[model samples]
Target: MVARRRHRLIQRRKMLGFSQEQLAHQIGVERSTVVRWESGEREPRPWQRPRLADVLEVSLEEVDELLAAQVNEEPEAERLDFAMRNPAAVDLVTVAHLAQRVQQLNAQYDAAPSASLLADAGHCHSQVTLLRGFAPNGRIRRELCVSTAESAILMGQLVWDASQRRDHAVSVQYFDQAISAAREIRDPILEAHAQLRKGFVALYGTKTPKEGLRLCNETAIVGRAGSNVLSGLGFLHVGEAYAMLGERHDCERALGAAEESFARIHNDDEALHMFSPTQFDRLAGSCYLFLGVNDKAEQILTRSARSLVRWKKSQSIVLSNLTLAYIRQGKLEEACGTLHEAIDLIAETRGGGGLNTAFTAGREMSPWRHEPWVQEISDRLFALMTT
Candidate 1:
């Protein structure tokens, strides 16, 4: 196979008048390491990224794009053509492969642009749908449908994120399709997961806390039969909705119930896609932020933000909330610093939740627009808009 050239990296390096050895020397790496990276034989480490970005005079997000382009030059369809061509081969093993592919794309959701993965995810979803129709056994067919529902939900999320959460109608339609697919397979867990995502649309996209609360309650009911983790997550969203509505008593009660459910969660729970351990504190921090408890929000978010470093998209949301908490407390410098972190994560992930939170943080900073730090942050936000 011919080696794939990192054209963007090469162009940037040459534009900056640097040879491979000089560039590597500047970043304290071996010239062979630079050669390997440019030849697509190696990738830059996370710790080395900032310096690489500085040397290339490119944003970290741009570096990510360049790397992804190099690594995935071949379309996903080409890689999975065998499965698509021989739908009759749609057994448990094939299903496992499809599910693994979906998981791989899902893992990139927090680190890569949504548009980058949307095509492959859509193709994978379509293949799964086709395979289910050709599946010889009821068990295989049902499993395929489960995977289809997951793919549909992931497509909805990617579309929403790619559109910056502005295309609510399309996202909702995908969720509805996923819900129907799940119902057809009689998988309450999958159906509940779809409903939970719909709640997110209602809460964040439509700005309807009451509707979000109702959907979240429904999710909790179905999730109870499926997964303790998902049920707890549903109640956590319910608490968030209550907080949005300024129902302090109800919010606290729902949060307590969520905590109880979380404590009962075990490793055997399904709905792995919809649940995470960091979720409780993340949502709790957002709830406190909504309820005007800045101190409490800051406390929870600061701690949770550290733990969420592995998930840049989630960490961005936490950082956004922490920025808001700081802003509310008149900690302008700290708020500005956190806002920058959130914006940087947004540039990398382009996730809807983080983007919306970053913008919200910007709007909240308007009162202090005269401050140099606030103005500098505003400039950063402006650059994001133009880009």
Candidate 2:
């Protein structure tokens, strides 16, 4: 229990944007102690609790409540319920929090025996619709909206999981419901996002990129001119569609348009949560990599790597692209290292599989499947895809 409190303290500290060393200095503890707390390997002494709470800028009572609520939550269902009720309280929580919340929701939905869970899922879906609508304004709004959107997204994601598990009819019904909710919210960006996701369902799982591209193109049309960030994302889908179609020139043109749109929106500081330099670079890098322009891909991807590392999110996608770039350069050892790092990072976040980022990487790497080192990585990655 004490160890759990310490872990929660570390989570709070991180959400507040404090580094381990910075937090340690503030609380007059060694950095090692902070690390231990984060790792759940040790606990702060009872006397240190107040100071820890103070340093985290959360009230001691609030900290105590959080620790008590979360420490004993072993099943995913309980965690999702807590997140739904305490959405506002979790704004400063880390990616880990979001992942855990999503996981619990998925688990509950899978094992559901009552209509209440379905209703709860619907409510969560509504919240996501609301939040995705709010994402274009700024960071504060994005942060505020994410908890709600996350809840909804998780429900939709569980539907997808069910589809994967052969509950096909149920999954299709759930997606339809989710899409309707998104439409009612009247958020073009999220509508576009939903369509993009549906496109993936068509392309990869259903083996119909043409149908997927049709949906993705609709998303781009709706998303364009809404937010520069969203516009770029829309273009990304267009580019992806072109790539899948084997239209290299069309892919390049769409990718170039994405980069141009992104450049116009680029800023020194994040302009809302909608647009970030890192995300733009990453998308550009991915497009170029797929186009087989290794030099251009490497340049853009390197920038993305640096930016994503600073943000501490999307590292898995970034690393996956970096591995592809290294493989292109015939840097076998570097590629292997990056692939391992990507796998580890993805395992840690455990949220992005729904995006099919890993599978996309595997598909992109198919060209190198015959290369010895690439084959080694491909074998491992393909196994993951199958299971």
- Which tens-of-lDDT digit does each residue in 1-387 have in candidate 1? 667877557645654446899899989999999999889788899999999988776689877855654544433345447657887765444565676676677668778988789999998888888888788757567767777888889999999998888899999888998899899878888898899999999999999999999999999999998788778988999999999999989999999999999899785676654567788899999999999999999999999999988899999989999999999998988988899999999888888899888989999999888988888888888877776
> Cα deviation of 249 in candidate 1 (Å)?
0.2
lDDT of 1 at 386: 72
Ten-residue segment with the worst summed lDDT in candidate 1?
71-80
State the lDDT at 285 in candidate 1. 96
> Could you say which candidate leads in lDDT?
1
lDDT score for candidate 2 against the true structure: 0.59
CA-lDDT, candidates in order: 0.84, 0.59
lDDT, candidate 1, residue 295?
99
lDDT digits (tens) for residues 1-387 of candidate 2: 444444455545644456789889888999998787766666578899898878766677766743553555444345435545654433334333443444356445423422335565665556444434534444334433434434554555555543433343454455555455446555555555555666656654565667766876776677663556666766776776677677778887877877876766643222234455576677667767767787788888777776665443356667777777877787767777777667665444442432255555556667667878667767766655554
Which pairs of residues collide in model 2?
A: 76-104, 128-149, 138-272
Clashes of 1: 0
Can you list the residue pairs that collide in candidate 1? none
**Stretches of candidate 1 above 4 Å error?**
1-93, 134-137, 272-274
